[model samples]
Target: MGLVVPFEDKNPDKGASIESLVSLVSADMERVNAMILSRTGSDVTMIPEVANHLISSGGKRLRPMLTLAMANLAGYHGDGHVKLAASVEFMHTATLLHDDVVDESDMRRGRIAARIRWGNQASVLVGDFLLGQAFKMMVEVGSLRALDILSSAAAVIAEGEVMQLAAAKNTETNEDEYLAVIRGKTAELFAAACEVGPVIAGRPKAEQAACRSYGMNLGIAFQLIDDALDYGGTSANLGKNVGDDFREGKITLPVVLSFRRGNDDERAFWRRALEENEASDSDLETAIAIMHRHRALEHTIERARHYGAIARDALELFPKSAIKDAMLETVDFCIARAH
Candidate 1:
């Protein structure tokens, strides 16, 4: 997770409302720094450095922004949104820390990751510290509803990590299984981000539910498109060298689609590459060729569009406002990556 928003459309105007709302989210991040720093104190030089390293690194911070924007759209004017939003960011950062250790990723946002820079031990403990901090912040917010939202999201995220481990190899990772993992790993956080805002704002239950659904769909679409890009997009456009999934013997959207469309021999090639952990250049070329032949990229794009639309529809329950417009822009940004 480099701060680079590879999935966003080149069009600046796509999700103007969400972007505008995100401006406030950015300001709130500063507040987050103050909160974290005061808690860490002078003894923790490495804590501050690692925290800054991860926070300052380029990131979309999309989840926290959703928190702020939904709060605004739902007519919540309190300052607590800032604290809650920061808590959301902290939770996300903790996840990134854990994900890196699990994935063994060396780079994020084109820089050596925290785990890489400070060592895995530092990364793991710091991640735990942040998770504890995030909960503390949530408790300060004093909203059981907010706690419920984040706690549920955390549980779902853990389920996703385990699900990925279980589903890592073998061709059984169908669209449904893929969707389930996406929901658990990515969409749950997105939903948590948006839901916290409305819950804190004391919004109507229906509206809050819609925003959660909207974020979930948006997250799903975003992750699916990312999986597609791993097979097709350039490293410059997609960021973080592609093919890590294939290297790790993980099956993603394009691979699944390609195998579905491949002939017996072609399918056998995938079986050997994925199941046996052996893939040659010819195998890579064949997989790429197969994805292209069956238009898997296009298929993935269409799926992303479907989710973007659902995200937009989630905003329909809200009255027209600058915030709503920004939310819509974010939806477009999510789908326009491939467009």
Candidate 2:
């Protein structure tokens, strides 16, 4: 399927805003928030301090919100979803803490990274602490199937991180390899988050699979847009410095495409900047210019739109409802951020 029609044309009044989804899950999110805060506390003062540093940062909390919304859409009527949603957020936060350390990032949500503030040792240990809390909350939920799904996702996400590390600065990384990396690191948790909604609600296996597909595709689209934004977006929108990827020698799709389309001299430039790690201050500007010349960022966004269409289509199994509409609009909202 293609992405031709704009979200506004499809829903003139609502458009493609996440506010609708946020509002749909607001009450459940309040409980999720409470659970998150309660679980973050620890006797070791540094744990809560480091964890809260990133937790209080102004993230949209989209993954947990998805869990809450999907559970509501499946007609759940219990407190299990609140814990599951909070678990999702904790997993996401933990991933961020660990990722910042791995990526050697300096900023998160426009503030100094927890690793930079507290040091890498503290950041990693607190991430481990959050993972422990997440599993505790998951076990409390009392669903073997849900626990299995999320626990497997944690392993998959770790594998994805290792895969990305192996491929880092390797200009030979292909589209297929990159896709596998994202599926593991980013999409698996999203899939698990949405899938558990139907499991807790006692919905059919088919419904559970559908939500999994929705979350997986939406996550792929989300990451693609994020990678593109590294080149084309501003720091205000990204919550981190633009061109960080280039400076760090990340082998993103934009770099891959530009490397393939560039001439010998341009390829040499990429190898020096990305592989050899010899980028000067002006190199980031050159990287952006090359990506723009080859329309790498634009094509990356097009690929995101493609996955977004699949995410929207995955919801065709469900009947019409406010929650379903909000979910569909959320796909648009994610893709629209690139513009």
User: How far is each candidate from the true structure, as Cα RMSD in Å?
Assistant: 3.6, 4.4
Model 2 has an lDDT value of 0.89
Task: Tell me how far the alpha carbon of residue 113 in candidate 1 is from the true structure, in angstroms, after superposition.
Answer: 2.5
Model 1 Cα lDDT, one tens digit per residue, 4-24: 223323334242334565665
The prediction achieving the highest TM-score against the true structure is: 2
Candidate 2 backbone clash number: 0
* Clash pairs detected, candidate 1: 2-109, 3-58, 3-59, 14-329, 15-329, 15-330, 17-325, 17-326, 18-326, 18-327
Q: For residues 155-210, what per-residue lDDT tens digits would candidate 2 score against the true structure?
A: 99999999999999999898999999999999999899999999999999999999
Which sections of candidate 1 miss by over 4 Å?
A: 1-18, 24-30, 33-42, 280-283
Q: Count clashes in each candidate, considering only residues at least 3 apart in sequence or on different chains.
A: 10, 0
